[model samples]
Target: MHVPDGFIDAPTSLAAGAVAAAAVAVSLRGARRELDERTAPLAGLVAAFIFAVQMLNFPVAAGTSGHLLGGALAAILVGPYTGVLCVSVVLLMQGILFADGGLTALGVNITDMAVVTTVVSYAVFRGLVKVLPRRRRSVTVASFVAALVSVPAAAVAFTLIYAVGGTTDVSIGKVATAMVGVHVLIGIGEAAITGLTVGAVVAVRPDLVYGARDLRQRLKLRVNGELIDAPAPAAAPVAARTSRRALWISGLVTSLVLAGFVSFYASSSPDGLEKVAADQGIDKRTEKHASADSPLADYGVRDIADARLSGGLAGVIGVGATAVAGTGVFWAVRRRRTGDVSPTAVENV
Candidate 1:
C-alpha cells in the first residue's frame, strides 16, 4: 500500500528512511553475490514486470482492492536481495513519476512494502523449500504461501509505524484489526498471482526460476531386483543458445499488455491501504504529494483527455522508465561486481 505524505510524523518517517537506506545499501552488496552477467538483466525485467502488474489491482472485498506487492514473486524468480531492489525501484518510480506514493513518505513505503515483504517472504519461502519435497511444484507452493504471509506482515509493519507516529487519534486496536483483516483477504489475491506466475516460469524453464534452480530431479532405475536412485549425471554446461533472452522478452510483453490494456478493466476501488486510511480516519492528516502537478500525476498525461490513450501511455511510460532505471542500476552493479570478481567470479550455471 502506498503511504501518502503526513501519515507518519517526520521523526518516525526519518527513522524509517534511515532503515530503508540501510536496507538498500545492504541489498546492493548482496545483489553482487546473486547477479552475474546472466541474471543481472533479468532482474531489471523483473522490476518492470512488477511495476506493470501492480497497475492491475484486483477486487478483494466489497470496496477494497489489492495489487501485487511482488516481493515474494521477485524473491522466488530472482533472489531476495535483488527482489528488494526490484520493489524499491518500482516505489521510487511511482513516487517521482506517477505521484502515486508521496515523496516525503518514500522511506515509509519502501521499508514496509519492499524491505519487510522481501525479508519475511523469502525467509518463509526458503524455510518451506527446505522442508517440502524438492520439486518444481513445491517451489510454486512455497511462493504462494510466502506471498500470502507477506501481505499481512506488511500491514502489521505499517500499523506499528502508525502507532509510533500516527497523526490522528484513532484507536490502535481498531486500526490493527481492520488493517490485518482486510489485508488477509488481499493476501489471497497476492498468493494466487504469485503462484500462477511462478508456476508458469518453472514449467517453461525451471532453470530460470531461482527458487527452483536446485530442483534437478534425479533418475531412478531398477538395479537387478530392486529400484534404486540412479547415479547422478555429470552437469552439462549450458549452451550459448540457452539464455534468459526469450523469457525476458516474454515477460516484458506480458507486462506491456497488462499495464497498457488489462489495467483498464482493473477494479477502480481504492486499494487495501487507501481503503483502510479512509475508513480508519488515517487520511485525515494526509498531505498532497509534491509531484501532484507533474504531467504524469495520477497515472495520466497532462492535457490528454482520452482516458485510454492517456492512461495507457502513462502505463507504458512507467514500464519503460522502470525498465531503463532498473537496468542501468543493475548493469552498473553487475559491472562493478564483475570487475571485482574477474579473477574469481564463477559464471557456471
Candidate 2:
C-alpha cells in the first residue's frame, strides 16, 4: 500500500526514511551478485511489468480492491535483492510522476510495500522450496504460498507503523483487525497472479527464473551395480538461443497492453489500505500529494478531454519511464560489478 503524506508523524517518517535508505543501500550491493549477462536486462523488464500489473486493481471485497505487490513475483523471476529494487523503482516512479504515492511518505511506502514484502515473501518462498519436491511445479506452488503470506505481512507492518506514528486517535486493535482482514482477501488474488506468472515463465524458459535455478534433478548412472551421479549435459543449441531478448520484448509488450488497455476495466474500488484508512479514521490527517497538479498526476494527462486517451497515455508514459529508469540503475550496477570482477580485480583479490 502507498502511504500518503501526514499519515505518519515527522519524526517517525524520518526514522523510516533512514531505514529505507539503509535497505536500498544494502540491496544495491546484494544486487551486484544477482545481476549477470542474462538476468540484468530482465531486471528492468521485471520492474516495468510490476508497474503495469499494479495498475490493474482487482476487486477483493464488495467495496475494496487490490493489485499485484510484485515482491514475490519479482523475486521468483529475478532475485530478492533485485526484487526489492524493482518494487522500489515502481514506487519512486509512481510517487514523483503519477502522484499515486506521497513524496514525503516515500520511505514509509518503500519500507512497507517494497522491503517488507520482498523480505518476507522471498524468505518464505526459499524455505518452502527447500522442503517441497524440487520440481518446476513445486516452485509455482511455493510462489503462491509465499505471495499469499506477504500481503498480510505488509498489512501488519503498516499497522505497527501506524501504531507508533498514526496521526489520528484510533484504536490500534481495530485498525489491525480491519487491515489484516481485507488484505487477507487481497492476498488470495496476489497468490493467484504470482503463481500463474511464475508458472508461465518457468514453462517458457526455466533458466530465466532465478528462484527455480536450483531445481535440477540429479541424474543417476548405474555404473557396475553402483549408482552414481551422471555428468551434466552441455547446453543445447536451441536452448542457448532462448535469450532474455525475446522474453524482454514479450514482457514489455504485455506490460504495455495491461497498463494501456486492460487497466481501463480494472475495478475502481479503493484498495485495501485506502479502505482500511477510511474505515479506521486513519485518513483524517492525510495530506494532499505535492505533485497533485502535475500533468500526469492521478494517471491522467492534463487537459485531455477523453478519459480513456488521457489515462492510457499516462500509463504508457509511466511504463516507459519506469523501464528506462530501472534499466539505467540496473545497468550501472551490473557494469560497476563487472569492472570490479575483471582480471585485474581477481589478481588483486
Candidate 3:
C-alpha cells in the first residue's frame, strides 16, 4: 500500500529512509550479478509492467481494494536483487511523476513494499523450489505461494511501523486485524496474477525466467533396461535472432489495456491501507503528497476534461517512460558488468 506523508513521524521516516537507502545500495551491487544480455532488457519491461498493473486495483472487500505489489512476480521473472530495483523504480516514478505515493513517505513505502516483499517472497520461493519437484509446475506453484504470503507480510510490516511511529493513537489490534484481513483477500489476487504471469513467461521463454532456470533438468530415457539421460536440445546459436521486439510490444499493449481501459472498471474504493487508515483513524494525521501539484498528479494530465482519455493517455505515457528509464538503468548495469569482466579492463586494473 502507498503510505502517504504524516502517517509516520519525522524521526521514524528518516530512519526508514536510511534503511531504504542501504537496501537500494545493496541491491545495486547484487544486480550486477543478475543483469545479463538476455535479462537486462527484460528487467526494464518488468518494472514498467508492474507499474502499470498496479494502477488496476482489484476489489478485495466491500470498501477495500488491492493491487499488485510485484515483488514475487519480479523475483520469479527476474531475480531478487533486480526485483527490488524494479519495484523501487516503480515507487520512485509514482511518487515523483504520478503523485500517487507521498515523497516524504517514500522510504516507508520502499521499505515495506520493495525490500520486505522481495526478500520474503524470494526466500519462500527459493525454499519451495529446493523442496518441491524440480519442474516448471513447481516454479509456478512457488510463485503463487510466494506472492500469496508477501502481501500479508507487508501488511504486518506496516502494522509494526505504525505501532512504532503512528501519528494517531489507534489500537494496534484493530489495525492488524483490518490490515491482515483485507490483505489476505488481496493476496489471493496477487497469487493468481503472479502465477499466471510467471507461467506465461516460463512457457514462452523459460530461459528468461530466473526462477525456472535451474528447473531445466535433462530429459531421461530408458534404453536396454537401463536408464540414461537423453541428449540435450541444441542450444540456440548466439548469432540466432535474439529479438525481444515482439515481447516488448505485447507487454506494452497489455499494460495499456490494464491501466487505461481495465482500470476504469476497477473498484473505486480505497485500497487496503487507505481503507484501514480511514477506518482506524490513521488518516486523521495523513499529509498531502509533496508533488501534488505535478501535471500528472493523480494519474491524469492537467486540464484534461475527458476522464477516460486523460487517464488512458497518462497510462500510455507512464508505461513508455518507465520502460525507457528502467531499460536504461539495467543496460548501464549490464554494461558495467561486462566492462568489469572484460580482459582488457581486468588487466588494466
Which candidate leads in lDDT? Answer: 2
For model 2, residues 297-327, the per-residue Cα lDDT tens digits are 9899999989899888888999999999999
**Cα-based lDDT at residue 47, candidate 3:** 94
Q: What is the C-alpha lDDT of each candidate?
A: 0.90, 0.91, 0.89
RMSD of 1: 3.9
Clashes of 3: 0
Residue-level lDDT for 218 in candidate 3: 67
Ranking by lDDT: 2, 1, 3
Candidate 2, superposed: residue stretches over 4 Å from native: 217-239, 343-349
- At residue 153, candidate 2 shows an lDDT of 98
| Superposed model 3: Cα runs more than 4 Å off | 217-243, 343-349
Total backbone collisions, model 2: 0
Model 1 whole-model lDDT (C-alpha atoms)? 0.90
lDDT of 3: 0.89
Clashing pairs in 2: none
- RMSD of every prediction: 3.9, 3.1, 4.1
Better of 1 and 3 by TM-score: 1
Q: Which lDDT value does model 2 have at 319?
A: 94
TM-score per candidate: 0.92, 0.93, 0.92
